[model samples]
Target chain A: MTAERSRLNLRDLLSETAVALTARPARTVLTALGTILGVGALVTTLGLAKTAGNQIVSRFNELEATEVVVSAQSTGFGDNTRSLNVIPWDAQSRLERLNGVTAAGTVSAVDVGDDLARSVPVVDPQGQTEFQIPVMAASPGLFGAVRASLFTGRYFDQGHEDRADPVAVLGPAAAQRLNVTRVDNLPVIFVGDEAFAVVGILADTARRPDLLGAIIIPNQAARDRFELGGVESVEIDVAVGAAELIGAQAPTALAPNNPDQLRVAVPPSPRRVRSDVEGDVNALFLALGGVSLLVGAIGIANVTLVSVLERTGEIGLRRALGATRRHIALQFLTESVALGALAGVLGTSLGVLAVVAVSATREWSPVLDSWLPFAAPVLGAVIGLVAGTYPAWKASSTEPIAALRGVA
Target chain B: MRSLRRSRGAPTPDDLDDGPLEAWAVPTAPAGGLSFEGEAVPVVVLHQAGRTFAGPPPVEALKPTDLVIERGEYVAIVGPSGSGKSTLLHLLGLLDTPTAGSYHLDGIDTVTLSEPERAGVRAARIGFVFQAFHLLAHRSIVENVMLADLYRPGGRDRRRERAVEALVSVGLEHRLDATPATLSGGERQRVAVARALVSEPSLLLADEPTGNLDTATGDQIMALFDDLHGQGLTLAVITHDRSVAARAGRVVGLRDGEVIEDRLVGSGMR
Candidate 1:
């Protein structure tokens, strides 16, 4: 009977403490709001940061190299602003023929008329846009250097090159734009009034900007038909040991157009870019998430302190009723922790909403991806836990008797 | 001690023994009364004990006075307002430490115990009934009673049963689940009594327990105290009413922190 009595006492104390919190719920809720906003702000910021990081990673993948880029610049050829590449076919061929070089490829900036656009988005009333996608056109052996595989049709060969066949492979971005749109063997106009046949559509690559509308062609065809009769630029793909060696001869042959365009490089594997982009995105998320968590802590602290004051008489009663000092402190702190955690949950949900909002509007491929819809909740949960800690601590430190006597 | 004896089934005027028992009311508990070897006793001995409040000018609220209270005795320490009545109660309750001398409760030297130990002793041995009732507004009547047992080890169901039993003892079974705020002034005091007795303390102490109640209600509460005394609990009460003091076995009148009269009522055989 005696043991039963004491046990009942503890249960009653905790229940009563919780009850005390509920009595001034309006005030408690008001205090809790601070934590909510703090957590929400943090989580949403984290979402944006993650998106920015993914954008950067995707950007890196777009620039993924067969060899480290020594430099880059405009092609500077006359009347070629609409051209897709600065690196011409002859320069790439010459670079590839070097002893230590494995292969060579080239890329350029091009403005393709929106192939599938009913209309352009994020533009002014003039019908012009700031969105310019990266376009790469490669020589015959370039595939060997960049390690890209053809999804269906074969990569360009010498016969097509010699005849300047104009058969082109569409990159992932272009393929997505033309998803099941059935444009195989269709005539597509390009630089120098060339008419090209769409051989195959490339899947969307994680690489952004450059790989979006990439158009690949063999060297012979590029040299015979597309070359503007000079060194447009050179992109050399050399062995690791010979990266610096290409620097020696790069200025000699291509300096006229290669002012900064002669890019001597070592290629990165596909896997490296994928993981790197994910890591970058996560780092950005953590930075923003951390800051918001601090806000949550402050919110929790304020609420707790207020509660301590409001419940002063209640605390005094508990003390008189057999509650120890430590018990009082623990009870208040526990309340704080609960509030912080609830706020965290709310904040995380807001963050997920942010990601959803972004996904609804922008067409840019996000670098970091979550599993279909559920990943948002997981991300939110993690952010919430991190943000709720300090608030919980602050809540737990209230002195029981003083807390009881404080006005709500 | 014979004057402190009860007439068993018939409650007598001097049956209640008041001796440092009021502090136990803070707990809604069980076994607040003292016990070690299957028996309980109330033995308070205050020797030259006093308290000083550290204000801008330190106020000596209580004067050193030697006192002793035997087991099963109902004693009323009477005094006028601000005549050190509350101060003496606080000191007896162990809620405050004395600035001088020493005190003993149930043969245990209080001055020598650790702070936490003192708290444990207070929890285990005292039941207090305040003039204001001081019931926690948030908890139900049963919960309030249960709080006194918080330091006592047991399971939930057992504690719950004891809480109900305590409420029944104070005739508050019908309002077991009602919060103090929902109770009337008299009912709240009854709940407070339930909370105090739930702990079954060695000493039942009252600091003007009926001060907030009307005359009839005050007398009813006093009668309730008289009935508890018949059950052999030690009680110490502080009151301004002469009639309230008249109900105790021994009445000690205080004038300016000094005991002016010590009188016995009814049978003073022991």
Candidate 2:
């Protein structure tokens, strides 16, 4: 008899592995669950990190980087003579004419004693509790610069400022305190015996949230009634990427004669903050994904080892039928790798679906790498190969005689 | 002899009228005295082959024994429990190496061959049928048969054709797509036989071929074995049943790891 060497072709090995794995459908699914969850978690976390980071950076750019504040530097003196009335009356128009500036306005406190500004026409003789609300004055363009939304009625316009109209805009909190909810009836509030008509109620402001609790009157009105002199600060809303240039030009534009008397404050660049936030979010999620993947790998290893033990008879029978040790080991290894690859595909699909579902609910755009789906299955196969090594070796080393005799 | 046959609950040689003895009916040397001249070399040759299990006190499972099986011969290795029958079968199947002595298969020195080489020899030259049927239960009958040639060098279609032919020879052509679980005990054994024959090995080694079957089913399997032997396939069956041993052309009685008897029995017709 010619001595013929035994051989196992790739086609047969794969077919045999397929048969073995598909024979028990339930076990196959159960064995693949860990890998599925691990890969799915990985993809979902990565997608959300990118998508959420983009959302945060865009919002930050809108609120922070687009705003520039120019304040008058107060001279070091107990008296207010030198520091008073330094800003031009045409500060809003002067800054707004700049190329990058969207809207600009000047604001100042009226300097009326806080408790003296009462909502009622007559003070109570019984010494009733009083609301100490601070009153401020702003130009018409301040509302636009601050991105203030109105709850009801309209803002006092340039016409009101030009005529020095005694119209007032109440912040939502101020409106609540003064018991004024609507401007349709033209409700009035007495500030130190001067009745001002409430024209609008502020709903929200994007830049300065502190202004939400104060009462705002037209700058000309504040100047005429309360003798408000110097402008405090000019708020300018510039287009994105234009804040730095406007910050540099605003001080000179507002006080060309005394530019040093004005100080410009532009928001710090958002690039560093965006990167830091993204890095933190990505690192946190990636750690979680890695832990999940490790657990999945452990699960695969455990299941493969158990399967090797359970299929000892099959391994022995193959040996008796001319299978070498390497053939037996390769059969098992290929089975696990196939299982992992199939799980990876399923996990990637599930992860993509999860990202889409979450983004839809939150109204955010989902971001994922184009190659993630293609690479996930390969990652899963590598995990499977690693997990199956010891178990395949164990299978290969089983004694055929003992195994066939049902002794193990 | 009558008392022995009655005690064993099996028929004597005289009770079988299976035609005249064939030319291979004459028994060869009982203990290593045969010469290899110009005749076809024996399919199996064991010279003082033995096996011992390692232990604090090593257990000798099989003593040094000499046996030669020629081509197309039907031999039965019969022994009671704990009589080295399983040990000798393991040795003959090359599932374990002999601790002492030498074994030659088709004139190749098997003892000196590497483990992988031994596996190659076993795959190409030996067919085994176990008492448990040893068929992959999940596979179709034809697929189970085809598994025998999975490690052999051949095209898939050719291997499939040979598998179908082997199944047809075992009268299982109709159950080609049926799983082993769907088959009866005898049909399962027949499928196992088909799987064994798929590789066209020189020697068929069956370990307790009918230990799990009823007497009638066992008889059917033995009849199939007789048919295969008539077609000039060499077979060595290890069984504890006297009736099973009585069906072979020669019987080698083993007791406590020693060969006690070697003699010709049933009509060896071809």
Clashing residue pairs in all predictions, respectively, total 62, 0
Q: Considering the two chains of model 2, state its CAPRI-style docking category.
A: acceptable
Fnat for every candidate: 0.22, 0.55
| lDDT (10s digit) by residue, model 1, range B179-238 | 888888888888888777765666777878888899888888888888777766778999
Model 2: how far is A298 from its true place, Å? 3.3
Model 1 docking tier (incorrect/acceptable/medium/high): incorrect
Best by DockQ: 2
What RMSD value applies to candidate 1? Answer: 12.5
Instruction: Give the TM-score between model 1's chain B and the true chain B.
Output: 0.81
Best by TM-score: 2
Candidate 2 positional error at B64, Å: 1.9
